[model samples]
Target: MQNDTPLYQLDPTNRFTHRTQDYDAYRPTYPSAAIDAILEDITPQTVADIGAGTGISSRLLADRNLKVWAVEPNAAMRATGSKQPNITAWEGTAEQTGLADNSMDLVTSFQAFHWFKHNDALPELQRILKPNGRLAVVWNNRDRTDEFTKRYGQVLQSVSSKPVGLGRLSDATPIRQTNPYFTNLREISIPHQQALTLEALIGLANSRSYTPQQGAAKDLLHHRLAELHRAFANNAGIAYLQYQANIFLADPA
Candidate 1:
């Protein structure tokens, strides 16, 4: 059955409320090398992680001893992400952060920027940044070149209305020097992979916002995923999912 609910109607802020646990558990982390490369050059001391879903990106910044403000709209995600050390959770979104002016050294959205209203979000992001502060947007795009990943994507796409993959956010970022919002968008792709068992793979599928949440479609999706695992798993039953952690760094124009 096709889900008649449009993608825009999914309430981008609250859609993941029920799926937070799976998102925290199975969603791949930004590669440490990618993190290192992002932070090595500028050395931002105060950071605001926008759309900080379960603090996946927040914790990485906080771990480096940087003060990170996790800005999230959903209560559940904010509450969970707040418990992390060195993170201050705020109830806000990309378009309206409610933070004071010139308050941050860096503003980042990890695997989350695509969900924002860029026309509205850019100014708010710029308002919070100190002069010369940078904004980093990262996405671990699913690599379909690998056979197992292709089959895994097929399983998700079968039941999805909008499909489970990055849209135009896959390759290009909206931020650029010519744009009114930001200047000099620098992009890089870092190869990454995740090894998981059957259950972890199920959790991975469950974590996606567009994938089936429950009901017959959800069951069928999981069943097909398990079948894919059985068919594609290596001798040790490890299914490898490939990704390219695309990092885009820019400063407000």
Candidate 2:
């Protein structure tokens, strides 16, 4: 892994605590086909969802009738997920999952892998995964090619005061190289989009890890958002947000 500071590491714990409501409200859920691709030949009985926040990914796995061991480090996020039935929510990080060795057939992380210390977590993943088990990393990335989306990104940067990392699929190369445990790394890109009102769009932005706006910054964020809404909002008063679900899968080396 590169030594560069990861955006997600900025404020690990409290970043999402305040926005948990909006997160569950506006954040896009992974597509069914995306999950289906990783879960090949494996029943619902053998799955471990590391960094399972708000049960978004965990509930999907559970819906497949598989028992889900939802491991999450954040207490607030874990509490949100605990309300779901049949989800075994554990307060644990990826590096120290507290799961038995070689017990899981599939170890999955959704929109959460980049937050982990991969060197410590990869070994834990290898320990929990059974022989020939699969490791899948899935992310729904924003498609900023659209004019409105591009402007929205600019608004985000202006408000957050953090460098918006690579905005293209090619920019994800470093993430693939972050760990050496997996071989046969393959990427599947699925075209996806979400239709959202201007308010929902702001909610989505607030839920991000790098959005540090508070007090005056928070007020300024809303001001900028209003300008974006006026500029981007169409006759229907809803903006079509485009995104691609990038699912990267590999097996133990």
Best by TM-score: 1
Question: Weakest 10 consecutive residues, lDDT, candidate 2?
Answer: 163-172
Task: List model 2 lDDT by residue over 1-253, tens digit each.
Answer: 2236764565555567777777777888887888888876765367889988788888888888778889987878878733556679888888899999989888998887767766687888888988788888888887789887778777777777654334432333534675556677888888777877878888988877667647988888888877787777789988777778888887876
Pairs clashing in candidate 2?
44-66
lDDT of 1 by residue, 149-183 (tens): 98888888888776633454453445753567688
- For every model shown, the clashing-pair count is 1, 1
Clashes of 2: 1
* Candidate 2 residue-wise lDDT at 83: 55
Could you give me the TM-score of model 1 versus the true structure? 0.92
List candidate 2 segments past 4 Å from native: 1-3, 6-11, 163-180
C-alpha-based local distance difference test score of model 1: 0.84
The 10-residue segment with the lowest total lDDT in model 1: 1-10
Q: Give candidate 1 misplaced runs (Cα > 4 Å).
A: 1-10, 164-166, 171-173
